[model samples]
Target: MIEISLTPIRRYWLASLVLLLLPVAGYAEDSVWKPVPLGDAASWPAWRGPLGDGVSQAKNLPTHWSSSENLAWKTSLNGWGDSTPAVVGDHIFLTLQNEANELRLLRLDANTGQIERNILVDTAETPREAPQRSSQKFHNLHNMASPSPVVSGDYVVVHFGNGLLATYTLEGEEVWRHNLQSEYGEYSIWWGHANSPVIFKGMVISVCMQDSLADLRQEPIESYVVAHDLKTGKVRWFTPRMPDGSAEELDAYTTPLLVQKDGQTQIVIMGGNALDAYDPYTGKQLWHLPNLVGGRTVTGPVLGDGNIFTTRGMRKPLLAVKLADFRGEVPAEAIEWTVEKTTPDTPSPVFANGMLFTVTDDGIANCYDAKTGQQHWRERLGGNFKASPVVADGKIYFLNLDGKCTVVAVKPKYEEIAVNEINDTTIASPAIANGKLFIRGKNALYCIGK
Candidate 1:
């Protein structure tokens, strides 16, 4: 090897160059496959919130807000989606179909109700295929743009019922896009698919729990859980999710919940007549409890007290299955409690404090003991609730399809705090972030808070 001796000035210049190169090398290493932070604790980074559970940790949140009082701002949007808004930092991300009938993602100024960026997410490369209008019978309340968007740090992921799943940066640059149906097969479900995308650690997770492939003439089709690299959108791993149900019962628009209990973390999905758990990092089927037998599950499960509260499809039973004790060989003894009456057929159950609160598709609201499943109270608030109830400041806020929000006390006893109203129609759930409520309606997006 030949060595060159340098002068003092030359040596100093070389040292500076080397120092700059070190950080570049380190950044390249850290940039690839790194865990994306979920962002501000007060931010609604996902469909439900930062915890992936439909509960927020915000305290002193507004208990009462009306159209004229405590009204922040109301901004008009192009089209509507049943999907909830995802808020990160100053931007609120929502998935919508523009007037041109193109699926899109909208970013709005969170402080003021103003459109910041409108990114067309569904392009020819990621085409949004509407099921034949003759058979594309979605529930009267939903459409193709129903799945909510989830955000984590610099990345925000949006999904549409038409199978377009795209990820973008907070600055509105496309990171990667994939059509779930294109890669798998055409989705043939009774109603359109509306399962939202979720994020865990270094990956963005998606679940397509639909009808059996044989039934759709796509013999190999199966429900699947997929995890992708947060930065590059590379498929980290794909796992086949086999839920046992028949025909119409096979379709599940339910989102998976990430539960960490008893020093063990697992992704819990409720669908196809069963509640199962999978290893989130590797997508391994860890342990599963079968025989739930509830079909077309819309209610996502919630966790509390070493047990998870789940609604078995629709109009069946609200069950609390003990998870901490059972591992393998799950049998009939796993389910600890069941409320078999007035369970919701559409809206999901929200677990907050020590109560499992649920509202039916019509108007009935029931509060049950989270552990025992004993009915605390059954009350009718009188509007049609499609949005899941949210809890904050010792009150539960339930928004109905008529744009009315009924605030209830968190006790076992039924107490109505306030019945606030908005004029627009909505099927989208309300999102809580930074001490404010973001509710997307058919005609507008309302930012309501004190």
Candidate 2:
């Protein structure tokens, strides 16, 4: 080794450079993935807001707003997607697919309604042979970008129906990506994969429930719940999830519901003729309630007041199961009550003010008491709906396919607050953040506020 003496000024500059480089090196070594701070009321960080429920803490949300009235700003999007925007601070992350089948992530300025960046995540690279004897066609209502982007700390994770799950910094820098089908197995779901990823405790969790093709082949495809490290894309755990069901009943297009009970965090999944919960860390099956099978699942589960509310599938009975001391197979008696009429098939139900609200795909809005499952009111909202309802400040907003939002108050009696309409077609569920409502439409992202 050779050493050279330097002047005092030169030594000082060299020391400054070393000091600046130290923190960068340390950060690279640590690679710590922070958890998103859900305490901030102004953030819609993931699929169903901070609590994995369709409830928003925002106040003064606009009760009446149209295309021109009470509009904050509207920014045109390049392509259409049913995935809702995930908002944190002043940044909004969304996913969409162009006509060329390019899956992309868009970072929008939440305050100004301007797209700050459009980063290509992946292309729809469906395998040449496709899966043998499996249906890969999604309904015309949604495409591959149906799964929404989720904000987890400084990184936003976007999932596409094509099995591409990617993470990027809020500034649109790509961090890591994985083709889940390549890692596990080909998707044999009847429609398409639209389950959004949820980030918890430094792990991004995803669920896959689909057709096993048991009748078509001697070997069956596996459905699974998987978790990956947020810092790296390395998979942390994968648990095979095969509920006892048949045919299309094995398929599900719903996202997992993250819930906490008795200080224990659980990832609740509803599909395949059953309802179950798993440990997010180890992907261990916790408790399951099976045999309530109906058709393929679309709506997800929601938790409110110590009860888990979910339907089997395809507008079956809406069951409210009380949170009890559950382990292994949850007994059938755990379900407290069921509402058999007007349950939603696509849009998930929202719980607010000791009641549960749901909008059927055919436009019937139904409200039931959270504890008793007694129907308080059932009224026709006059439009087809695919987006789930969001509740804020004691009011529920139900947006139909045609961009009509009927805001209703949370009361035992049916109380319609106001009906707001926009010209663009909307299929995505509404997102609330920073005291404003963000609606993703076929042509634009509209910000409505006063």
Candidate 3:
């Protein structure tokens, strides 16, 4: 034992040094792969394109694409989902669920449509046992991954209906995972939650809506806008809604919109019976617009021209309110206008060039004056539209569930510019990024561009 050599000790020290530096080297490589942001108006990084308004600033986006024509590339997805694709830099990210309710995240090379990585994020612990309702009834679109993904830089965030929220690196390594369903979320309404997560600053915001069950004596079921630290999956703050204790009115399936007005950043959330605003940084409620009738909300709110526009009720009215000041309760007079009949129950509205444009779930596109509530034009594009419309290059692209996209000129007068069809059914909305359009169908993802 006294003959231990110094050479062996030196060899061990060198091996330890290399092991210690390996992680640092990998981190440095990751930091260099920052995504190239779409600087122009045509690219969309998240749901409904840029600004979360479904309006594209891009001009000259390809209007016609088929299986062989105008298509940049088409890739067959491994799993099925109703979620849209998110493009950031050279990669596109989306979520899908297997027949067994096992959720997966996929990353593809945006230019080539080659799948870079497919990672299994979460698995449903138990099989769905409930009886399937008829087509007339609204319930969880079983096995359909309906939540869209949000991407910033190299980090991609996704929410699965099973209450799983996860983040991944550009290389497809899972960074963080959280089970909102098991922790604080419960299935309440007929349709499972369909709200897409929105990113603000460094946090990811999601709406967790669950109704209180009498049998469980659940704590007053509350809907909340929760901000989580992007890197750690830790809840930063939770802004709770005023509980109504009514099971039918306790759900919110709307994504929160982050907007900047009058030098203040606000998070706007719409739910069963109210539209509310909060400070994005601290989760403090700034204002609440109450008395909204109880009905499941699907579309989130949109902000434009210093006002916030929201739709409520499964078959109700659309409301537009001006947010000129933020210190107190907004006066009733602040409501600019309300529109009844033909308001969308699923897709959100789009604002472009001083006009408000929305497509009804039945395929009617309505345009209104942005400053006033005056109706400008209403036209039937002729297909049911569950996906939202995107405006790019002064043109509006409306993707319908029947797989037809009606492109129209975004003017006060209605003008159908072009009609393109892909033959595949789609429930997810389209995304525009890097001069290309991304559409998620029932079984595939398509990239269309010039």
Candidate 4:
């Protein structure tokens, strides 16, 4: 196991200088699209579990637990971040940054919740200000470690708000790293960047949907989707993503979602007033549904029952778009149903058992039929919510900011089962594996199991 302690000598100036000297371009790798293999059923390896949706196969998950009851282990993690754990096999990968501004990655033992490996990935400061824009500030609730670590192949890719994307082995050996802003341009987003990278076939995909600065100058800053070689960190392909929106409407903190359908896979992204898909192998735009026209988006899209469900930013209407063999532009008829009331703004929706569940940042929970879009029930779960809900066993877990998890049945009707409290601040979403629940709080990581 590796442990890296933060020292006074480590600084961001050295890291920035090293990244600025690396090459800016590289040749594309093979174009054959081989999907990322789902290694184990008991692992929650990515942002939204194994399927990139918040549904877990783990059974008999504990529905009720306090800070002392049904607790497997609680390990105190230094510093703070709002990233969900990437649990694979017996290791849990997480990212955080201390007051020293040192971005770090820790691999913990799953059974004992012990920190097995801790590596200082990079150093970056928070509230990275734009040139002359004071209104474009990062929120106080999150920092550079807000983007979660993604485990792909034998490497765990971690990203920081400073545009530092680095890959390290599971054993804490560095593979390669890149500072995106050094190669591209400085970010001009309203808030901080928090988009987690997604692993596709043989490559890692990342999205940057931010302020174009078109409102400020003649030529707008480019927002693009870029793919890099999983093993070498070389740029494989880059597709410019200039959507038809302006001002804050152009900003998106949402992550890229990989959707596999009928033996074909597409990278689905929701932001910049549009929902679109891209070819995984070639970095080409596949199809787009334009004119979504919502404010800066944070809520991501979810797939269920042969349809894509998403909400526009700022509590806009929820959309249920049907899948099609679309070419250039998706037509208006592709929309199956829509619900305008009680939609979520920050937390992404979760689907299970033909029912979809969503909780607004204000704590209102709404259940809908996954296919018909009919509202089955709407109830308040209480407390503010920033974490997305996760479903396991026969219940859906709605975690609030106050570290309270309200477990409800997966049926259409609202049936509350248990309300568990941990006496900590939890904003990151929960991860489930092997019949146990993993929750990352503000100061500690808690494992709840029977």
Candidate 5:
């Protein structure tokens, strides 16, 4: 190499300095992938668990835990919320709302029940008059942070109903924020939005089903499912739920689930007055299952064994349809069957073994054959349940709103094993990870394990 002049040497030195600082400058841009350790056998990772199907692979989960026994640890939460705890590695994450309707995200160490970080997220806007007759009076039920946090590797995604979607690192550093309701559309409901966000293939998906009955003349009263880039807060795709409708009943609060069948990926959405499927990659409508009467839906659809199971919150029938039937404009025939009595109107159904287990909003737990909708046994577990049931290690866990947890055996015959109790009520679903159980009560987050 030939020696350069002083000026050129100075320029070379500056370039070298820039390169040395390039890694620091691009630290945010670098793909910082955090390996989420498998949770304890008694811990929960997300609203449901690792599979997002409400089933835990762990075998050593505690069968009983109460206010004074079998509890690994119980920590008082700062705010009120129905959002479930999401565990990733040794950390537990959740969202809550204080009395002022201020949203907050909290992370805790799974081992010691110590809070790692708690950050204030959003403050609810002033409440307008109730718009719908079916709306419940607003209470301190932590409605603002009802949607649970979903942890994907190092990043945790939280959705605050009124349209705030945010991503934070495991260390509680907020990466980016997006106000989808303000930017895309406002919520249509009087009860407040409660749809949770889901992640798949590097995309974070959310369903905006607003039912603004008072503002019937609103221009953009459309219901849609949107996907955003997980790393950057960029819109990837948006599929409108209703093409040309202004009906508030078409709005929903149900989250969509990703299903893969026959080498094709479909995002199954149950909302408003219809059941529909969409191409997850492009947000293209694939098929529709109409004739569904719209109402306030709380439970999302569950996919299993090539079939989709869904529930409409109102006095409607529970639906189960085969996924292959969506290949055409309309299915040739009705795929399976439906049950009206004792069916779940809130909690999502869980499929384990060859049986389908569901707990209704009024606390009725029923077991049915997954292949057919035939009921095996119906029993009242006593307390009301808004959270779904979780199956782990041959046992089914039911969390009721009264803070009672019933554990049953997942067999052909129903077997009530144990009824555990905590101090506070729990509307958020239970999560299982590594080998621990994470339960988010109205007043505390509990980690039950060895």
Candidate 6:
């Protein structure tokens, strides 16, 4: 969606749609095109795409699109969210919160961009923004639906800043719903909660990095990560994480990254003044690197070349942690490098074609060698950037907040492809599937293809 307007990470702990062995409910059988399974490489089932990275396996995705050119379908959305649309089979799902604060799960027909169903899962009487925050309202730029939905097999999990978590079938039948505030306590974040859920091994996982309630109440104001059963929405396991940082330094809006290397799987989570790897199956901490103690973190972390590059939150040093022999406390040698200047605060960096690309919130773009951190290129693209780039067809598409997309080649030297613009302002990242690119803006959803 590209609205000339307002706006809004997530876990890579996901299951392949093929692993979703349960059949989609019969309501979708009448479709002429077979729905793509939620776990297929070609489907955009979670934040950043199926592999949990920004790069898309899609070939021949549209390189050109505007308000009226190469437009396949355009559907108007009722509310605002900064979440990327999740595509599975022939349906697209996005969470929306209207002015009334009703969080809705909307399913649309992929081929025609026609509305299929809109299910109201939950509603919050107060604004999505926290009460402690002033001059901020959820309806203006973003709301509880900022966290993108995760589609795994037979279930689609949707979460919101207001603590609502619900599951629905592919056909939009309600399965189960719960609230984090009810399970835990009131939210203590300064702004709002936007951590999205990740699905893995039949469990949907989520985490929160919030402020301590030591000043507000007696009950422990703890931060933790937990997983729920996909079928029953029952708690599988919960692990409390107490970072040593104080106040706002503990706030984290980053979504978890599922990294697998050397035959082992770990959930890479950053927040509360540290970066830690946890076992997805048992909710156990595998390793941690602490003392980051920076401001609130927004940029989701990325992985490549045996390293994980992460923004230390709030324009702090962008640290590269090497994972060759990481165990317990991270060794000093594990930090390959730290790039302090011109790091992104909101947008996550992308690693592609032996290069690392980062765009600051103010729109400064930098490219570095993935292994040695050698500067490849640095240039300003103009405008504010919050949406992460989409990599495909040997090109990276960088989107600004004003809805301008600057396409650049992925090579040692930077080469501009084309700059395209739409009618709306946008903050949600783009998704690619079935040879088409799906973009969500302030008020509408646009599909671009040849």
Model 3 regions more than 4 Å off: 1-43, 125-144, 212-218, 243-245
Q: How close is every model to the real structure, measured as TM-score?
A: 0.87, 0.90, 0.85, 0.90, 0.85, 0.88
Cα deviation of 353 in candidate 6 (Å)?
1.2
> What does candidate 5's lDDT look like per residue over 49-110, in tens digits?
66557877788889988767768888997777777788777888888887777889988888
**lDDT per residue as tens, model 6, 202-225:** 888999888875556576477899
Stretches of model 2 off by over 4 angstroms after superposition? 1-39, 125-135
Best candidate per TM-score, number?
4
Specify the poorest-scoring 10-residue window by lDDT in model 3: 1-10
Q: Is candidate 1 or candidate 5 better by lDDT?
A: 1
- Residue pairs that clash (backbone atoms under 3 angstroms), model 1: none
Candidate 3 has an lDDT of 0.72
Tens-digit lDDT string for candidate 2 (304-381):
777888888998878887654356776565677777656789999998888989999999998888878777888899
Name the runs in model 6 displaced over 4 angstroms.
Answer: 1-38, 126-140, 215-220
Which window of ten consecutive residues has the lowest lDDT sum in model 5?
A: 1-10
Off by over 4 Å in 4: 1-39, 128-136
Deviation of model 1 at 314, angstroms: 1.8
Which residue segments of model 5 deviate by more than 4 Å?
1-45, 125-129, 133-142, 212-215, 218-220, 243-248
lDDT of model number 2: 0.83
Please give, for residues 1-450, the per-residue lDDT of candidate 4 as tens digits: 111111132356345334333222331232222223444667888888888888888988988898678999999989999888999988999999999999999999999999999899999788745554322457888898888888866889999888999999999999999998889888878788889998877688999998887878888888999999989999999999999988888889888877764456788899999999998999999888899887899998888766788887878878887655466776555677778777788999998888889999999998888777777888989999999999988899999999999999988788999998988999999999877999999999999988
Q: Candidate order by lDDT, highest to lowest?
A: 4, 2, 6, 1, 5, 3
